[model samples]
Target: MLDMLTRWYQRRFSDPHAVSLVAILLGGFLTIYFFGNLIAPLLVAIVLAYLLEWPVMQLTRLGLPRTLSVMGVLLIFAGLMVMAIFGLVPTIWHQVGNLIADVPNMFNGLQNYVSSLPERYPDFVQPHQVSTFMITLREKVLGMGESVVKGSLASLVSLATLAVYLILVPLLVFFLLKDKEEMLEMLSGLLPKNRRLTSKVGAEMNQQISNYIRGKVTEIFIVGIVSYITFAVMDLRYAVLLGVLVGFSVLIPYIGAAAVTLPVAMVGLFQWGISPEFWWLLVAYGIIQALDGNVLVPILFSEAVNLHPVAIIVAVLVFGGMWGFWGVFFAIPLATLVKAVWNALPATEPPPEEQVEE
Candidate 1:
């Protein structure tokens, strides 16, 4: 067993490039694990730079200087962000406050409905069972309320951090975008000279991350706008809030859509219980999801995501546990990075079994 392990290790690590690749991967993982919070602004800037790089490139192609291109793109993006902050955010926050205010009434209605379930389905649901369920649900709701209160208190500090980010992120993004090549050259100089494998992986991830970010941002806006329009047309309350939820839901693959359905259905049911309008709203939502999965996703992410459903879910759970929302958001790409590294690594195949096995 020791000999077999040694052979496996030697076969895999014999190449200098493979060793370099492993070191680079380990270093990156360690850095993120240890200092991710400390360097968050820089990381955010890097992500935004990736998102804006394409447009900068296009502008540069049009004979504009790169510095000027970066300025133009940064200003446009910042303006849109400012607009969202002042215009869209307040409405969503208002809806959120309204939802919180309505939660007690909603909970009472739910309890009343559950209490009726025993009579409606006497054989399947007993009074005790309904009582147990309601007790558990009430506890959960109260716990959620407590959590919300804690989160609200915590958000005061977060707002101050956000203010710092608002100032620092764009400056970092501007320099990162404008001095892209110079920064790359400097970073490359720091890496070991034998970095062929690292370079290969980096190139693949650079394109993968760029495509994924662009496709995702586009998906969010398209889904959000369509959902908002549908909800508004149906006179659904908190259309903007629900729309934004539906939009961001795309970030988590299978889990997100399934999770968001409850809120949409609950909102609709409470507003228009068992009515044709509620049914139509669900149908429209289903169609939108179907089209997004079958059409928009394929068109937008033709070459971006190539992972299996199981792999994707595992990535979401694992990386999300490690890094929270950003992990979930970049789960697919991170999984792809793992896959790429696995494929790129040198491996040793076991010897074939002898014919005597038959």
Candidate 2:
């Protein structure tokens, strides 16, 4: 067993570049795992810088100085963020308040409907079974409601931290965008000199992650705006809130869409009660999802990483469990990084005797 382990280690880490790459990767994983909360603003800034870099490059190519380009992009980005915070957030919060106020009515209606299922289908749904299911569901729902209240209170306590992130993130983003090359040079200087494999993986991940972040942000807006417009036109209550949920649902791949469906359906059911309007709303909503999956995703992600569905789902589950929202958001890119590193590893050749036998 010892000999076998030694052979495996030599086969994997024989190259100096491989050792360097492994060391760098291990260090990064350890830092993030240990000090993620401490450096969260830095991470957020890095991601925003990546998202904003494209526009800065565009302006620079159009004869603007790099400093001027960074300023222009940063100003526009900050303005949009301010508008979202001041204008959009309050509306969503109000809608959320309205939804919470209506929850008791909705729950009562649902309980009544479920209770009637036994009478409507005596053979399929027994009264005792319905009673037990209702009891379990009510408990689960009450638990969730209590959790939400606690979360809200916790968020209130963290407002100061949020303000700090808001301030520090933009400043960090500005310096990052302005001193991009210098930062790269400094980081490169710190890494081992024998890092050809690491450089290759870094270059690939740079393009891959940039495209993924920008494309994902664009997808979120497009879906959110379209959903909001559709819900408003159909006179659906809590349109903005639901639209936002549907938009962000793209982050979780298959699971998000499935999960958000319940709220949308419940709201519609309580409002229209199996009427034509409700059916039409559902049909329109379904079309949006279908188009997003079949159309928008392919177009946006054409130049992005091409991961299999199972691989994508596994990445979502594993990384999401590790890093929560950020993990789920960057799961595909992280998985792609792993794949790139593996592919770049030097392949060991068999002995001449084995080659001759073959």
Candidate 3:
């Protein structure tokens, strides 16, 4: 049976191809089946490993042992996690409580706005009523309401999974940090090469991943600081809460930070009215993003990583479908790793490194 199996496989695809196909299908199926329970935490672990590797490498250069270095990384990580939870939980909970308390006020505002809209257009029907000419419109609005409720429920489920991720992240991160080198070595051995090529690719990918991760975290911290200072100075309500959210969202590529600011600013405008405070948020965020784009990002993330904007969108779409927010959050990092692997292929590599463009 073994001889026959070998003959059939050897006559068809290469051994590597056969093994890789099996690995891909099996791993993919398992990931799909256990995504909520397992895959997410594993991805977080990988990303955390990326973030910590630089400090670990730096520690080794400073003459610390690998084990000690890894421990230091874990310590810093734990300290930050504790500090963030302490700082953020109260602010977020406070903001959330305020929102809950203001629900009636918000509904009043919505009702007032809708009333005003009809007056601005006299031909417009009452927002909540149905007349001979507006029955279809009323039905459509009701359907819209149902869709909104469904969307809200979906969002709640996603949020609950995020809570689960918070629980899993640290545990996974600890193990990943401790077993980083061993994992890399074991995975590298499975690569179909004379070992040297695999080792080089592995090392290059590690460096790229580590650099990207550290740079991104530093960027987030800087953005957060800039936002907090601005919001505090501007005297916006829930400024700290919104600022921290903006800072973290900014870690996502392109649209993340800017996307959240619109709604946040609108809330400020609505609540605070069109005063200096109302407009200050827009100006502050605009300036912060400008500075980040022109100075901070270029200085900090010099290598650029060469990911296409189109690639980023596709990744967000694909992974967002599979894993929702997490897929969106970690899409860029996952895409980066996938890109590195794709680029490493002999058929995919541009002639040679030296021959490639500067």
Candidate 4:
């Protein structure tokens, strides 16, 4: 066992560069695993800067100074943020408060409907079964209500942290964009001189991650705006709220859309029952989803995220378990990073067989 372990170590770590690479990877994993929350703002800033870098570069190419380009990009970003916070956020908040206030009524209606299920479908559902299911569902709903309350309290406590992130992230993004090359130089200085593999992997990851983040942000906005307009035209209640849900539903790919559909359908059912309006709303919503899956996704991610559906789903589950929302949001790019590293690393060649005299 000792001999085998020794041989394995010798075979893998014989090169000093390999040892350095292993150390770097381990150190990065540890840093992220242990202090991810603490450095979240920095990570967010980095991602935002990366997303904005293209526009900055385009401006520079058009005869603007790099500093001016960075400033222009930052100003545009700040304006959008201001619009979202002032214009969109308040409406969403108002709708959310209304939803919360209506929860009791929703629950009561659900309970009544469930209680009637056994009578409506006597052959399919039994009274006892319906009773048991309703009891369990009530408990789950109560638990969820408690969780919401706790989460709201937690958010209140984290307002200071949120404020810090809001102030620091944009500032960091500005500096990162303004001194991008200098920062790259400083980071590269820490690595071994001969780091071809590292550089290759980094470059691949940079391109993939940039495309993914930019495409996703664009998708969210387009989907949200379109959904909002569709719902408003349909005279749907809580149009903004539903549209936002539909928008962010793209984040988790297969799962988010399916999960969000229930609420949307439920809202439509409650408002219009099994009427033409309900069917029409669903048809329009379905068309949006179909177009997103078949058209928008392919266009936006044409050269980005070549992951299979299974791989993407696995990435979402694994990373989401580890880091919640951001983990889910970044699963594809992180998976791409893994794919990049795997492709960058040199494959081990099998030892040649020695021929014996016949």
In Å, residue 145's CA in model 1 sits off its true spot by 1.4
Error of 4 at 290 (Å): 1.8
lDDT of 4 by residue, 1-358 (tens): 9977766666656556656666676788678777889899998998899789999999999999999999999999899889888998899999999888877877788788888998899999999998899889889988999999999899998999989988999899999999989999999999887676777777877888888889999999999889999999999989999999999999998899999999899888777877999999999999999999889998998754468888889989988887777789988887777777655555554354698979
Q: How does residue 129 of candidate 1 score in lDDT?
A: 94
Give all candidates' CA lDDT scores.
0.90, 0.90, 0.69, 0.86
**221: Cα error in model 1, Å:** 0.6
Candidate 1 lDDT trough over 10 residues, lowest sum: 349-358
Any residue pairs clashing in model 1, and if so which? none
lDDT (10s digit) by residue, model 2, range 1-358: 9978877777778899999998999899878878888999999999999999999999999999999999999999889988999998999999999999999899899899999998899999999998999899999989989999999999998999999987899999999999999999999999999999999999999998999999999999999999999999999999999999999999888788889988999999999998999899889889999999889988988753377878888999998888777789888888888888888887684233445644
lDDT of 1 by residue, 1-358 (tens): 9988877877788779989999988998778877889988998898898899999999999999999999999989889988998999999999999998888888888889889998899999999998899999989998998999999999998999999998999899999998888999999999998889889999998898999999999999999999999999999999999999999999998899999999999899888877999999899999989988889988888764467889989999998988777788888889999999888887865455478854
Per-residue lDDT tens digits for candidate 3, residues 1-358, read: 9966755555443335434534553575467546655565786777787787777878999999888888888888789889989988998889867755664565456556555765677686655552432556456656866896898789988998889877788777766777776976796576555444345555665676677777778888899888877877877667777778878876566678668777577668668866877777678788888888778877775655356778877888887777776667656766775666444434322233366666
TM-score of each model, in listed order: 0.94, 0.94, 0.70, 0.91
By TM-score, the better pick of 3 and 4 is: 4
Worst 10 residues of 4 by lDDT: 343-352
The TM-score that candidate 1 achieves is 0.94
Quote model 4's TM-score.
0.91
